[model samples]
Target: MFKKLLLVVFIAAISCTKNDGFQPNGDVLSIIPLEKCENGFAGEYPCNDYDLLDYISLEEIGGIGTKGNDCWGWTDPLDNKEYALMGTNKGITFIDITNPTEVVILGTLATRTVNSSWRDVKVHNTVAYVVSEAADHGMQIFNLEKLRNVTNPPVVFESDYDYTGFGSAHNIVINKTKDYVYPVGTTRSGTYKGGPLFINIEDPANPIDEGGFINYSHDAQVVTYNGPDTEHQGKEILIGSNEVEVVIVDITDKSNPIKLSAISYSNVEYTHQGWFTEDFKYFILGDELDELRKGLNTRTIVFDFTDLDNPVHHFDYSGSSAAVDHNGYVKGNTYYLANYTAGVRMLDISNIENKTITEVGYFDTYPDNDMAAFNGVWNVYPYFPSGNIIVSDINSGFFVIRKSGS
Candidate 1:
């Protein structure tokens, strides 16, 4: 009887080991290629593995500051060279990514105030605009063209313009068409309290505070959509990822913005960030804490934004891995998702109207199974024309990748 009991316990232990989700031998901090699995997809394309193209070690660039959160890629209109502007606790690090194989570290501009964990960057014309949530850390402006003249590697420089008014900001987005900058999450007290701070950056180096709305916006994407509402035609609409709901606001008049409506869906656990479809019909939202709290993969809530006042939840697509969803962007029919440890996932949303998303390819930067943590890919930029995808990893650093065959 004792031998039988021991045998049963051993078998149970083996079963548990087989079902374990942790990848102990995996490269938790290294990029690896993704293998093709027919769990759902019909066709098998050449999906390249998440190869570690290059790792920008903190020692090589600069030690991590208070926080290194977001990044933006700037392209020189004259030379047509692409540069990466990374947001750190200290400030922003500019790198020339013209050569994916060899990422050149241009330099970094320290924070205007004390360093914080969160910082965001955006580019307009030829200038880069940065914002951080550090105390007294207002917005800083730098001319990106100056980077072209850097003869030595890692050339350090100071900010040319410091736009003061808001002390701290979580994220900043620029509206090139209107020359306006939207700074979301301004206060450091807590979530759902910081409103979006709007500033006009028509004069690259010099920014003017136009005004902002206190709608408690955490992150947002602004665009002038021609679909749906006729009354809002050609008007700039701000889609904010509020704490509990997606707030749609008409910010055409920055001084006095009107709240269009607020939309929410089931299993909503922190309405963090979202992006709109190219046709302005659907809005993809990312729940920051759903994976940890809900015991499921990161849930991406898709909503029909056809009616500005009445947004409907169309469908929810959850990845196979358990990685949490962070920031995502839509280009044409593809939804580029920064799936924490899962790396960057490219979803084919050609049939978004039917609420169908096919995972065509994925670059698993974090070899470990997706878990609820901020130690993996934080953000991805896939609009780099050259098919080279750039992922900013929290633990492993930055990676530059191209499509498999490309």
Candidate 2:
């Protein structure tokens, strides 16, 4: 009878291998081939011009129990290999997506603290800087180059450096151009009131805590000013998506960050995230709760940052679906938006001056419904040089998509 019970326990453990929660490592399933979008679907996923190259389910990325949050990409300059860094409820999973169809699960860096639904990652100088909303989870910095020489598969990795300067950050933004890492949404009562905590990551391993902004910024994009604003030319500017208002700061001087302007819209729900156009002439803003609160479609507001001191509201571009827009980034004229239920939608902003932006392509990961609820993609990284777009779905997992021909 004891031997039979032991046999049953062994079988149960095998069955539970796919279960969620910390699983130490992940399983690498068969690679999915490229499926072109036909009619209204790409394989089983609903898509348009965008074709699904491959998909790594949350279970395969981590475990069946874990859900994905944010995602970012890193391209190794040595071999020109692209990797997808996907955030899970527990930790961040790295995958070699150089060959999207036949990708491999490189490894995972478990969260510093307890698992939470919110985790973010950004890469700089081949090092991935991760953050999570989990309690006491400050920042986990892992050497991404270590991925190149992995002898065994799906190895459980450790952080090279852990900084406790501030705990629990919502997002980590790296201004590669300026070589500074900004951790936003920190402790609300901290020095900057949850704004941007500037940490100079010039030395990727050892980061220096410079200072922070005081406007309570939830999300921001910092860039070296080369916009139409001649007054602030060549300055390091930060466009922050503060809750109730959009605040622009001149972070050139770490000791004294200057607030250039703070602007607000009419139906402001929650200023979630946004990105600037390549020309720096316009800034696209996404209000997280505007859809549910105002009963509106996915509305993306555009701001004309021509003048640093006074950013004027350009116009609002309403998407066909009512899915809440979580995060978006502008790559040239294309705006890659992670519309919650609508999946990853690509908008063309080539004609922003005339206020004409159109949705070029989209892949709806959540086929249930395009409601205002947050159930689909949390973030998208479209800046990969290979033209491969990687999206992080809250329910599904990681999606590697690209233009039909590209």
Candidate 3:
């Protein structure tokens, strides 16, 4: 009778454990906690199962390059091959990511100035424009085509053109449709006043300085879309993240640009960076210090850009992790975010009109809690043709991943 009782208890314990949940290697899979829903906004659900893939190691990639603060992927329009451009404190590293399983580091171009923690890259035509915050660092232009026939291992190459005048730049954005490259947060002491430096890169090798919109800017995005500011139809507009508020400028005429207006939401922390939807209907803004200042976890503000001059607060979404958002981009209806410590999260914003965002899928490359600190994923490039995502981690280096089922 005692033996029978022991068997029953053991069976019951196993059943209970099976019903509780599956914990693989001590990592739990479920939606993260969320703040109480407010203002009729349904909070985002925690990600179910996020696969953390650490495919490439920095030590394996020639050992000359370190993990960077930002990354951008460019596809060779001629051959449809994909190349990854990763920004490092020392320089920009290029990799051929055609086979994510075996990423190849083609080459690297060291910084023009002393090494610094920040670097940004943008591609136009067949050339890449790299900028960094190092002292006296100007934009370094490189012909990406050099990666086509690289037979040797990773080698450093001299820049094709060094546009020097403005020293350190915090970020670089390209208006591909207009053939203009906007370099924001530039300074040499106070001549340009660190706004957005506009350069006409119609000719990659020779970039002409086309003036800029000055104000104190940290990051910006230039677009020629028909949204909010209709009076400026078919005109180029610059949406900038100033230290205090988000600024909109009419940069159609680079020589005589006009500051249209500025917008600010409730929790006005540092207005860091933002992106517009593919349809150009809504503008998503990120506050760098909101998590620290207001104690709100991962707060992302959305603005209705239908009326450019008078932007309306659409809604706000908070995530489970405490990590602060650095840079984000909207491709189609999906928003790919670089949450510093939480890693790269992909959100489906199809319901942005209803002020709702659901965390469809995520890959936690950082494997740490998402706090408002600069320790993990800095930027992610999800534009690769194969749907492969390239992420740059401040500490872990570059990673190339695709959906597990895909």
Tens digit of per-residue lDDT, candidate 2, span 1-406 = 0011111111223333332111113222222336778898987788889888778888887876899899999887776677899999989998988767666898999999899999999888888899999999998989999989988889999999998888899888877788789999998888888989989888877889998887677889899989899999999999899899899999999999998898999899999888889989999999999999999999999999999899999999999978899999999889999999999899999999999999999998888999999799999998776677899999998888888864
Q: For model 1, which pairs clash?
A: 32-50, 33-49, 33-50, 34-49, 67-89, 67-117
Error of 2 at 390 (Å): 0.6
Find the number of clashing residue pairs for candidate 1. Answer: 6
lDDT tens digits by residue: candidate 1, 212-299: 8877878999887687778788999999998889999998888789999998888778899999888888999999988878888767
- Which pairs of residues have clashing backbones in candidate 3? 31-46, 32-46, 228-306, 228-307, 228-308, 229-308, 322-370, 322-371, 323-370, 323-371
Q: Which candidate do you rate higher for TM-score, 2 or 3?
A: 2
TM-score of each: 0.85, 0.91, 0.85
Give the alpha-carbon lDDT of every model.
Answer: 0.74, 0.86, 0.76
> What lDDT score is found at residue 233 in candidate 2?
94
Model 2 score (lDDT) = 0.86
On lDDT, the stronger of 1 and 2 is 2
Put down candidate 3 lDDT per residue, 233-331, tens digits, no spaces: 788888999988989888888889888778999979899999999878899988999998888889889998887877788999988778888889998
- Total clashing residue pairs per candidate? 6, 1, 10
- Model 2: weakest 10-residue lDDT segment is 1-10
Candidate 3 TM-score over all chains jointly: 0.85
RMSD of each: 12.8, 9.6, 11.5
Which candidate number maximizes lDDT? Answer: 2
